[model samples]
Target: MNTTETARRTAVLQSALAKQGIEALVAYGSGPRESAGMLRYLTGYMPANTEAFLVVPAKGRPVVVSADKNRARAFKTRLGDEMKIVKTTDLTGALKEEVASAAPRGGLVAQAGEFDMTTALHAEFRAILEPYEVTDGYGIVTGQRLKRTAYEAEKHRQATAIADKLVAHAMSIAAIPGVTGPDIMAEVEYLGRRLGADQAGCWLAVGERPAETYFDLFELTEAVGPNARVQIGATVCLDGYYSQVLRIGMFAEPSDRMKEVSERLIAMQDAALARMVPGTPIHEIVDALETMIDAYCPYTRLSDPFRFQSTHAMSNSYSDPGAAPFLNAGRDKSRDAESPLVAEHQVYEVHPNFTLPDVGHVCAGDVAVVGGSGATWMSQYPRGIVRLA
Candidate 1:
């Protein structure tokens, strides 16, 4: 991300903290991948090894505390010059010193986020930052992130464009004889990088039991064969944003049932888009989508009766931990009702997938923004089954 984007995010976060009565956000990152969510949102620093923390006080300049001197040094050279950067073995002491001036009105909070920290680490973190009430208030910041700046919206468009191209490329080669699963994987990865992605990844299931393999996520043991339907999922990361898409690649003529199911999936997504109006409870939409799925789907997945999530929030860190609008809305009616309203500007990946008697896991998915009247597609491609041959 550019300096402007970081500055805008920092300013917005500061305002949000002030509103939530949160003194600061102690976003923790055990490694670079972990850093990609909250920590990187502020410091522009992805920790190489050891732990890193970005402390953002409501009324003060943010600071980055890192145990990794090497990565910290590199961050300074590349991006951390605006914020205070302290390389230290005493991470907690550094954090304490930074937040010392803030009044103890709002609680001090930390974000171990999606991957909650190990018990030992959590105890240590709680112990050293004593005398103040510490809480998991990451939700406050996540709620704020639901609204994206114009910069983020544009980046999201570009990111999804990469994945669209990837799916297209895979389809172009699907009918080629002698093409294997690895061939498509290799081509997609190479093409993704060539298209200027920070990272590109794919999950595929081809051959006879394609649905079963696709259900397994990374299944690619079987080769692409004639008359086989290929179930594929693709993700591409560019800048700090990521995009995802899923589609079925069929080498033979699709059955009438396949076309009908594909159309139903499209209508399902349309129903989902209508629910993305700002301030609507996400759980309401999720419940509605589940009803649609249950009503439309008649058969179990090839391997078993299990089914995957129908939808989720997506953007930074893929399904972002630092963003609200998650599908896992809390269970309690009181809490679940309050579980992340459908805020404007959040991106969600809606992929309703299920298996058929003859076809494997048929899927149609895309990334879209929740704004204006409802969700708008960031993914600009065909939404149904892609006939390759």
Candidate 2:
């Protein structure tokens, strides 16, 4: 991130903090495996083995606290002298001191836990900052992450392009005779890493006939027959942004029944994409998909054992909000389907899958971005079946 972008994001978050009556904000990341989102968002640097925290007050320059001197020196060189980088053995003490320095008045302080806070970390934070109120700032950071910046959108586009390339490569490999599903999966993972992907993972299913079972990489051991149908669902992450591509391929000629089912599934996906415009409620998008499925495949009910989410938010994580918005036959009041609106620059993976009684299971989808007027696709692979010779 450049200086201009950093300034813009800091201003945005500080404004949000002021509005929420928060005097200071402390965003923490415990090593590389946990709570790295907010820390990366603020510093543009991801921690590998050390814990880090970013302190942003209602006013003033932000201070970054690194767990060790080595990491602190590296950040100092990277972020320059404009931003303060402090080395501290006691992370909670450093956080309290920085917050107190920023907000001498001792108003409410928000700590971003990212997902959920563990009891140990929460108790430690509370112990140091006595008399001052501490609240969860996960929403404050994630709310900003939901709307992608131009830089973030470009990163997502690159990630999607990589996913499309991998899908095409997987299709070509799946067409080869005597190749096992696990072999193809290994090649996909290898190529994804060679293409500069930070992390890559996928699910592969191969069967002579359409099988309702969708297996992950570990479960794929059977050799793909000459005329088997293959399904590849791939996800690639580049620079912390993620994109997905799901496709179906056949080694031999697709039968008439396969073509009909593939067409119906593609039509339903297309209808749903058409309605994914800016400002549209998530529930309305689900409704449009449900209607299309009923009009085209009336017998297909949401009660089918193989049904999955129709739409889901995508970002650095595979599932942004984690639990995605789904469409069901009967309105289940228990689902949180309402209130979230698709805003400009938001990316969603529109994956819709259903089981066909005779032909097994059919699935198709790609990543799309919500624009000013409508949604545009990030992945360019064709939606229908890709027949291979």
Candidate 3:
């Protein structure tokens, strides 16, 4: 977190506050399980305990509230004197005190209730603030985060590198006969940690017959047989940022039909990537993808239960914002709905998964950064089928 980055973020947040007529903004995050990313995004620090709060007033320096004083001290060193640290036992009470002290007179306040604020906590804030109106602050923060900064893009690149390494390691071990889904999953997680990833995990499915429906790695116990089809969906997080990489592995020779379908899927992925230019409407991208898949591989149309959308934005957290801007046809009513314009510096995962008529599931994608002219892939691993010995 450099001075420039901090200044940029603060400016954007202050602008948002002015637009919303909010006198103060409060964001909360519990550890990894909940709103941790929100806290990390605002303060460049994550809580070691149950919860942390970031209070940004319309004026004066920002303050970070946490239950653990020791953790707060550590953050103070990194964040410098511009950020004030407040240690308290009562998290919500401390927040109310801060808001009251900052605003004094009753004024509109915005709170990020979506992340870590529970119903009781929200009520506590309202009751404590009294006349001050509390509105949703999630959009204000996320609106600024929708576009990645250069520093953020670099962190995502590092995270995606870790994900690529994990996927490569999983593919290397997946080819051996008798390997189970959990086997590959475990190796990926282990290697991901060794590579300095904050956390990592993936879902795996393995089966011999091409027609055999894949099951979760937890529920499946059968060893992968020769000619097995494997689908691995892997994610790696580094410093609160996340990246996803999906791969398909074939243990033995692929049939002609399987080869054809895999080629078509890869082509579809390439076409989608080509369209991820800055300012392109998300609906146009989806329309082009739908047209291509329908024309090339009609069997894997949107009507198929196995088909999924090819584009999704990835950032500080996996599926941040929660609502996917694009969805495969027939899956969501908003499939054709317009989404925010694709802006430069935004990152996305282009995983297009669908099942072939007689073959199992096929999945392949990599992290990509949107560029002025087009999108550039962060993960260098090949995008097509991986044939294992």
Candidate 4:
């Protein structure tokens, strides 16, 4: 990523702040891995698991504060002369003090979240600030990120291609009756690491029963056998950009029921994607998906086995983009889907699956983006289940 590109993004963010009458935007927290994301958006320094904050004041220099050790690393990384690295211990207070001293008359301050502010920190901000706004900067930042600049799109394309290679390797060596899920997971990790993946995590399941949701990085399971359904996928990070893949393998021959469900699932996915073109209301697409599900696989009788929702938003690590234009299940409603497409260049991984009451499970998913042409698939993975035996 070019430093000039990052500076342009930061300027856009500052413009957003200016509209809100906020003179400065401060981002700090231990939970957000994208702390570096915020800074890199301002200055091009990708900090790892370390304490850091970005001070985006309306006027003057925008400083990236970090510990002395981290400062050395940031400097070595070549974040440009614009960044001012400082100690991390009193980072929040230090940033607040700088804003206070510089503005002197107290100006508008914006934070990523209310939770990111401690009670004391909130009080201190109020004391030093005239007017303040609690905004989700992630949304503000995501709006800029969703539309991939030519440079960003190219990087993501590389990341997606790497993920495709890893998926292909895993598909080729899929386990049969005696191989465990962990055994397969090991292969995923090896392939990813060898292919320049920053880190890879996978969930492999094989059995007659549908695999339970496995969220951990590494967990072993027993062998997959005939008549069993095996599903595996991973979230891969490459050079700070992210992509994911979800695929299914079968050891047993497909039964009539399996074939029918798989066909319906693919049809549903195609229907969903067909409605994903620009200018089509997002809810309209979501409605069509649910209506098709109900028409094809009545939910009341098959609720447990079948679940489908809007495509998931992509970010550094599945970071929520607030209200971006994409259909998603509502936070409170399990069956409710709410989202709309905002613009072209927004990326998503559409993982739509179908589960039969007793016949096992089948699913298909891949990364795609809304564009002038239409919804485009990122990877050329097979849409239906492939028999391993």
Candidate 5:
């Protein structure tokens, strides 16, 4: 993140704090996963080998807490000395002191995120805030992340470009006479790492779709056979931002039934994509999508044998069934589909996919951006199945 962009994002969060009358905001990030997403958004700090925390007040210098002095020093040099980097052996004491500086005695303090935090870490975080009135502050960050800035979109594009190559290579390798799913994924990983990707992962399913819709990568030992109906997906992260490409390809020409279903699935996805207008309610889109999908194939995401959805939101986090843009039944009724307006620049991974005995899992999806007037495709690869014959 550049200096200007960093300042812009921090200002947005601080403005939220001021509006909510919260004294200080504590953001927890534990070791390089989705939990680190908020910390990265506010401070451009990605947790390397250890857990870290960012404490930002409505008005004051933000403090970043680190356990490793070497890691702190390296990040300081890379990020410059604009913000304070505190090397703390005593995490609770440091957090309390920093909170004291920004917050008034007996004032309210809000936490940015906690759902993904480890249990022991969560207890420690809560222990520090137990003195003050606390409220959930995740909405504050989720609001900002779902919208893609030109900078974030650029990173997504770079990741998606590499993801495209990964998918294409996997499909081509499947056409070879003898190759297991893992064999192809090994080459996919090497290709992604060689091209400057930070992290890469892929999923594979060959032959007719199994009884279950969700396919596990660990059990992907089946060899690619002639005319095997293959479904594969590839995702890579560039600077904590993720991009993915999913496709269904065949070694032989796709059967007529397969072609027809692929077109229907893509059309169903388009209908939902076009409904993503700014200011629209998130649930309204979900309801409309379900109705359209049920017209051809009766569906409800909640009842899935695997907890997947027809569409989902994504940002720096690589976790599945993302938060905002689409919310399921949960504690935060406010964030449920019925609430939360679709922001102007929201991003989503749209896939109205399902399994069929005739064609296997019909996976086809792309990253979508809702900007300017309507929806636009972030992945250069058009949404459809491929035939390598």
Candidate 6:
């Protein structure tokens, strides 16, 4: 929220606008929206359980449209100036009026469809702005967002550290016998919040693959038994920044085969991490991972229902980012980096997993930041599988 950061964000938007030949950009989002990050990244405001739309022109104070009831809160948070608080029923109508009044006639507007614009809104805008040009602004926003600044890197580091501590506590608890999946899950959530994480994406699976997963549950009674495998992943978000950590636990002592498999998977992951230099192309990193997997376990497929690629980088994408290569499997080869591996100031998470049917899956991972020559592990977590009992 410093002046320099504010100016930097505004400058990013302006650069995108200029490159895209846009005079102004209208970014909008509602109801657990994805575009909220883009809006929040540009402006420090984290919207509550309400919809928000920010109109950033090539100049002047940006206009923020929110529910009438949240007007005071919006100002207090300093989301934006020129606030236009409108009734829920009249939200869309109010937005139309606001944009029409402030934006120049026939000026271009870039809209992010991922979260900002709904199907109905898209139709409505297409009809209303027929005379004016509006384009899918995904490219503009994504291109700008692909690289993280120093400030964002620091936020990720803090969030990742929080996850690291939460995982340590959860792992310690999971070591006890007769502990149910839900029990450990609650502890994980609690620890995440206590460590300054405002939000937590806690994924827990017990006894192979559990059909029902409780994200925010506070209790568990089902006890984990011998050979039972539990996979846990927690994405800790601080303020508006996020970083994720994943781990696997077993209630009984690991079998010889299991230990061997885990060691092999860890080795493969280490090889990939070794290649994560600043100038290394992302595809090459993925390729190295696939090569290791194929050499060790050719029978295992790199998809769900089996051992999915675990060694990949981490970013804010809620879905999956930095998935390892399935180069021979005809998967999409085009990731962010095309050729010539990237390095330096880049952050990635190396998670390599191996799945055995009816037995369970094991995920070993750590966040890494690409330095000038190589990569540094950000989260200090055990790299191999851990037995709880």
Q: Which is the leading candidate under lDDT?
A: 2
- Per-model TM-score, in order, reads 0.85, 0.84, 0.86, 0.81, 0.87, 0.82
Q: What is the lDDT of residue 151 in candidate 5?
A: 80
> What are the runs in model 2 whose C-alpha is more than 4 Å off?
30-35, 45-52, 66-90, 209-217, 293-303, 322-338
Report how far residue 6 has shifted in candidate 2, in Å: 3.0
Ranking by lDDT: 2, 3, 5, 1, 6, 4
lDDT of 2 by residue, 1-389 (tens): 45666677889989999999988887877654447756666776555567777888887889998778888997787678546888988877787788779765457988775344468877876675666787878778777876677687787899999999889988998877778778787888899999988777677767765555444656777778876788888888886677989999986678898888788777777777787777776666667777776565535575565666666777655566422433333556466445467777778787777666666667887888888888888889887898866
Error of 1 at 269 (Å): 1.7
- Candidate 3 lDDT by residue in tens digits, 276-306: 8888865555566667767755475645656
Candidate 6 lDDT, 1-389, residue by residue in tens: 44467667777777777776786677765535666666666665554455666666666556666655565365345633333334345666666776776566687877764345668876776665565677767557655555656676676788889888877777777767777767777777788877777676576666654433346555446776666676677778776666777777766677787678778767766777788876566666666776776666535563445554444444444322223232223457564444334646566666665555444555666677777788777787775666664
Question: Model 5, stretches more than 4 Å misplaced?
Answer: 32-34, 69-74, 146-148, 210-217, 298-307, 319-338
Model 2 scores a TM of 0.84
- Segments in model 6 whose C-alpha atoms lie over 4 Å from true places: 1-3, 31-33, 45-49, 71-89, 114-116, 176-178, 208-221, 251-253, 298-304, 307-313, 319-330, 334-343, 357-359, 387-389
lDDT of 3: 0.73
- Better lDDT candidate (1, 3): 3
User: Which digits, one per residue and each the tens of the lDDT, describe model 5 over residues 1-389?
Assistant: 66677778878888889998998888877666566777767766575467777888888767888877876785576456656788888876787788878787778988866786778877888888877899878777776676567787677778889988888888888887778878877888889989888777687767755333323546767677775777777888776677888888876666687778888877777777787787776665556666666666543444443324666666677632235435432235555644656665566777666655444456677777777667777777655667765
Residue 213's lDDT within candidate 5 is 32
- After superposing candidate 1 on the true structure, give the runs of residues whose Cα lies further than 4 Å from its correct spot: 18-23, 31-36, 44-50, 77-80, 89-115, 213-219, 299-304, 321-326, 329-334
> Could you tell me how far off, in angstroms, the CA of residue 37 lies in candidate 5 after the best superposition?
1.7
* Candidate that beats the other on lDDT, 3 or 6, i.e. the better one: 3
Candidate 1 or 3, higher TM-score? 3
